[model samples]
Target chain A: MHRTIVDADKQKLNLNLRELFNYRDLFLILAYRDLKVRYAQTFLGFFWAFLQPAATLLIFTVVFGRAIQVDTDGVPYPLFAITGMTAWTYFAFVLNQSGNSVIGAQEMVKKIYFPRLVIPLSKAVVGFVDFAIAFLILGVMMLFYCFSPSGNILYLPLFILLTIISALAVGIWLSALTIRYRDFQHVVPFLVQFGLYATPTAYPAETIINSLPDWAVAIYYLNPMAGVVEGFRWSVLGGAPPSDFAYISFVLIGILFMSGLYYFRKVERVMADIV
Target chain B: MSDIAVRVENLGKCYQIGHAKSGDFRESFDSWINKLRGINNGQTGESKEFWALKDIDFEIKKGEAVGIIGSNGAGKSTLLKILSRITEPTKGRFEINGRVSSLLEVGTGFHPELSGRENIYLNGTILGMKRREIKAKFDEIVAFSGVEKFIDIPVKHYSSGMKVRLAFAVAAHLEPEILIIDEVLAVGDAEFQKKSLGKMEEVTGKGRTVLFVSHNMGAVRDLCSKGVFLSKGTISQQGEMSKVLSDYVNSEAKINKEGGVVVNVSPLDKEGKWLKGTFLKVEVEWARNLFQEGINFDFSMRTVDRVKLFAFSSEKRPDFKDLHKRSKITLLIENIGYVNNELFIDVGFKYVNKDSYEALILNEQLITPSKEKIESFLRRDILVVPGFQYIIE
Candidate 1:
């Protein structure tokens, strides 16, 4: 018989990774429920998944390519924008969904006991489901542009993993904060809208990096999504592999993810009362 | 030591209410700014603190069904919540020997937009059941709920009774080592409640520990072998079910010593909400000057824990105007059911001058136990025919 301790100790800071793993089925189930519920009665149905990023791709190509004329580094602007949008859409989906997952599932959290981490982590599956559909649309765009992906496609999965991690890093922090500080609840959508531009989802990393001031570029590099989006270009579009500075984004993602975890665990202990 | 399923050591939970009730970032932010400006308006942080549970200690042996009973706000839910690990205690610790699942609600995570089949999977997994395990027990759960025909229909379409049944059915399949159930029994129809009770008994019969929190003292007495009485966040008494049950009833009687009325119903139906019984004793504390005119009592009975009225006495024409201060008014209510122990005892009369009289002072309702074991009274079944007995001072 295994034993479990319930206490008032405020110093317990471990992420309880084992519990999270044990609850992996619940995480995936929650994700499946979300995917099912999302398209249940909608006439648009699964098309909504493709519609969001495809629509955004069209808008970005027209606005950024036609008006401001952001550089695509010689690639077809539609192809460039769709690839970045694919990665960015999944990142944004995760941020928007996981950030709100805790507050959304407050009733479950207050009533049941499981690793609270499962709720937000389950949302990553929902992201990937929509991301898969968006990825298919990107494939269609690649065929339409007649640009076969380069051998770098092998690393596409790694970039996809990084994008999710990047979103989770910030999403985890936002979720805990949203419960305590509802200000974050309203701020999240605005943050997602702002983040769309802050990361190199629309313009190539090369185009913006050349124009921004040295310090501005350094701060920009801190966004882990930059590394993820750049990796996407490198893997899918066959660019000269991303710059060495790109590794900083991975390190930043690591630090943010680790600390976000600890902060979430710290908040989770008291979340029931607060929620 | 291994026989124990759960152990607690002086557990306590303190809540700072009022301020931050909304958890509004604006409020906290404004307060922080105000503090920076050396402002002391005190409107921002007017939080009052109270220990919802404190210095609580109890343990349940494996296979025991322990009932935790208390009046509302007496910390019953708080204690259960802590034990469920829904919230952490502020000052102590507890230990569990094995996996514990707390059914704080019947449909804890059910999504109305989803079908019954989907919710079973969602809710089962949320309660820590493996998907394969849920699938294995799938047909039994649906059959138990009697919602097999509507399993594919969205839960929102099912009647509330169907929903509760479906939810309870899923929870019943969770064979955790320790099952903590809140007052979910108070829902569903009388028959369904019995089914759920039997289900709980079956779970414990298999040697799993059960901690139940319910206001229906009768069900508690019947189902649980042990009882823990809580009052104002502390354990007042705990031991065998019968003794602790009597203590809880006594505590309710003791708290009504202040100027108020007490109602006594005999052979109380322990588990059934729509009760079959007789006799309601309305004893108003004779100290207060209640009225000057002749008082006519109107008795009514509602199902326990619900507001629906089953029997409302038309009016008692007996005039107790001249009855002395210490007199007890005894009015007979026919075919009366053991209710929530709530009665109108309409203590009013014809205003010696006006055409109509109106004064419905809703006082706190208390159940006064006559000195005897209710279980013994319940078995005789001879107490159903109760007549009024008035005592005059």
Candidate 2:
């Protein structure tokens, strides 16, 4: 015999992982649905996934690598830039998509009851698919550059995991905020634009971090993406290991992830009313 | 086995009515901060509390098909929302002894780009069916929706009726121990509606618990065994389906014998001057005991055949508030939506009672404006009746 109890109020937030697990099919379906809608009827279709980061990599190579002459140590510029762009593009896309996922699903959110977290998290899964496509493009560029990945390639999965968590942390926060204050809706695109220039996407992280002072360097790692982008480069290009300040980025990501979850749970309780 | 399928205790939902209507982000944020600082109590006359549902307690036994009937704003939907977990109540709790499936609307998650076949699987999963379960019922749902020829096409191209049929088919196939449906049977052609109603009767015949909310009296009478009538957020009557239906119809629609205002709206003034297009003047004179605050007056204009045309409520009028016991209300409605026809006017006054509004009285009036006077004054070159359909060639 099965029984379900519903209370008017919950005194504290419960991180009911078991309940979320029961709705796993919903998460997968939403992700699949988004992917289907995104590429439907377009002539290029799924290839756009590879083209976005690939095209951006070309622009960065011409503008930053050749025109500005940002140093890539000894590696070819396209190979060097694509690795960073791969991680950054996935982060930005996930953050932007998941940030608006709740608003985009106003119809479903207002009508039915499911784990609201499933909506935002599905964007994370979709982002991973796009990342895989762009990653495939990067592998061909690596072969073209005649570069072999180092033993550090084994640690690529850990860096990828870190990128996903950081993106989801910031994405969930912005998504919940968008519902309450639509100002965040306009603020998110600006954040993504400003974040692109602020991170070490155009140049190597070592180039900027090496010049900063002790205190400034410590503060620089507070941006979680700084370590992730550097880790992506290190894993693919066999360059210098991520700086010791990488530990600060890891801690920052953890704090952001926890607080993002807490803030989302708080706002989610009142979403049906306002949304 | 437990005979009780659902048990609700003291269920209540309160909304901040005034401020929630529509406000700019900055203003709302300021209000939130002021509320926290205790500088703004939020109990100001402008921002008052409204309990959409209060003190609702009921028990539904297994195999009981209950019909929940109420007029607009009567808390019928709010109760369903709480039971379906779409929103939480402010207080109390509920328990269910079986898997619950609630369909607030058909095609809740249907995407326009997805084909009918894909939507079947997608909507089936959303309604809490496993993939294997959906696969098993796939052919049955397709057969029921009867769009088999275009099953592979995107739903966007299908006619609206076809979309509703497919959506209803997916929803009705969900097998749960408890099913809650809300006004989803209004769509589709009459024959299709009848078929879906037949399917619902089949569902309840198997001894499953069902809670149905519908305005269709015939459908409710045919499907539901017990009935619950809600008036202003509280259960006013609960008993056999026929008894509750009669009570709701007689009280809400058949007019009240208790005191209410008699309305007189005229196209021509007392001086016999034909009034022009801009105003439909209604003068309501009532000399009765008045409630201090939260007094709402509603004026409904319906066709002579009893088809409702339009309704105007004084609750939205901030200026027409705080009135004395003996007074006359002269309303100047700009661009009234009407044609040259006889109409009936029903005036109703509602007041807050036990956190929800209860109708104090309702007065109905039969009005026939002078067509000759209105036509002579109304310019044939210009049509002043707002929302009236006109084809000028």
Candidate 3:
């Protein structure tokens, strides 16, 4: 006689990665759809990705480099601004788009059942594709300026990963919140626009750090994007790095990532009903 | 042998009902006040909690196709949502031994901007089909959906019927271990409905479990071997489809008054007034056969203000005669009086059908009459008895 054992009491929600892995092709397709639709009919196509950062670089190079006279660690103002804006633009775009993923796909979510995580995750993945296009533009600019990447450029991938993780952390939180409060839909665009100036996206962090109190500086280090921007500059430029601030930023990003995941899972089960 | 494929234990879902009036300023003020109280008010004003599904329990074995029948707001959709894991139950537990796929709404997972071909892969993925599995069945899905020429077009451009057909094709082709469908098959034309039913029958033949919810009794009887009747968020009856359906019909019959038929005249309103004349009267005649006894049905009509509009019986008519087998029964109204105020007219009919011992009654609102147009009331066919045939000279 064969006894089939069933763990009746083992009632817990398990993250079934195997199932997610099986559906990888679907993920790729959806991500590809996002990329294609975004640029399909536009005149600029992928050039829009580069143009945005280039525009920001031009403005920052004038205002911060000339007017404020912020030191860019001996790098050209345009180069400094484009490098930071490239990374920041990708982060901001991913954060903004992924935060609205679940609510934006309300029709799909209610009609079919899939791992809800797939929606936001797919947005993040597609944002990376855009980031890659923009990154190529940044590479061309680096070549034009005769700037060569040093050994520290090897760590650029880690910084890129950090930016994605932080974006996703914030994305998941906002995605879940947006389902219940549709006002978040209106709030996100403004938040992203405001965030660009608040963070060191258009200017170097040193100018702002020098003017702040020590306690305020400590608090400023808590902004995960601060470390991200500083780290990107250090990795790409291979100059002095904000090593201590980077560690704090990494820790803060990790905490944000985990907490965002927890809140997202908590609210995920109710999304269909509330949405 | 415990062969249960599904076990639902004491499942319940609660929803908050808001009573916000349909205007802007009042609703916004109510919402603001509620927010000020820090109540996280689910909605605005005079709110009440409703149990969409309460303490529901049932079990289904493998290969059983159970039909859920209910009127609107009867919690059928809530039950399916819980079963499909689209939403979690507020209480209790349910377990399934096999993979479950739900067609809650056809074309739900489809993105309108994407082509039908791309949507198929996207929908297949959402339904948990592997890429290679979808690839193998790709041609069959397209063929079954019958949108071969339009498959490359963006679904946003597809007709609503075409969208549903494509969606249903993807769902049915996947062949999940358990399928939960919720009235989405009602979309598309009649031919497509028939084809979809045939496809569903083929799916069930493979011994997969199916749960179908629909209001159409004929379709339920034809497709489902078992039926569950839900009333007020509870299962009122469950058994063979015939028995359950009979129970549902019988229960509905009891809720409606037996000797009263209602006629709604709201559809006849014209330009804020009624098209009919002031005085209105209604009569119902029930007959069996030429030799059989004829029954005089009593009816009454009233305005929304509780003013007696008219009350009469078929017996009061001068031409009334005993109805026999194959005899013509006519109900004629005489001397329709006048009206004073714009009012809502309601009519009721009471009689017993020939086949049953219980009296059957129905009531409906006739028309909304304004005070200015009280003088112009109309007399129309409240009920057109379709089963009667006449012999011409």
Best by TM-score: 1
B226-325, model 2: which lDDT tens digit per residue? Answer: 9999999998999899789767754653433345444455443554322334455567656556455667666666553345556666666555566434
lDDT of 2 at A159: 93
What TM-score does candidate 3 get on C-alpha atoms? 0.76
Pairs clashing in candidate 1? none
DockQ of 1: 0.68
Provide the lowest-lDDT 10-residue window in model 3 chain A.
A1-10
Give candidate 1's error at residue B303 in angstroms. Answer: 10
- Candidate 3 chain B superposition, TM-score: 0.62
Which lDDT tens digits does candidate 1 get at residues B259-377?
Answer: 34444333323441213344444443333355454444444433333333332332343334454344354444333433323322233333445555434323224343333323321
Clashing pairs in 2: none
lDDT, candidate 2, A10-66, per-residue tens: 547876668778888888888888899999999999888777887888888889888
How many angstroms is residue A166 displaced in model 2 relative to the true structure, after the best TM-score fit?
Answer: 1.1
DockQ of every model listed?
A: 0.68, 0.36, 0.37
Each model's backbone clash number: 0, 0, 28
Which candidate's lDDT is highest?
2
Error of 2 at B331 (Å): 30
Candidate 2 at B218: error in angstroms?
A: 1.4
Ranked by lDDT from best down, the candidates are 2, 1, 3
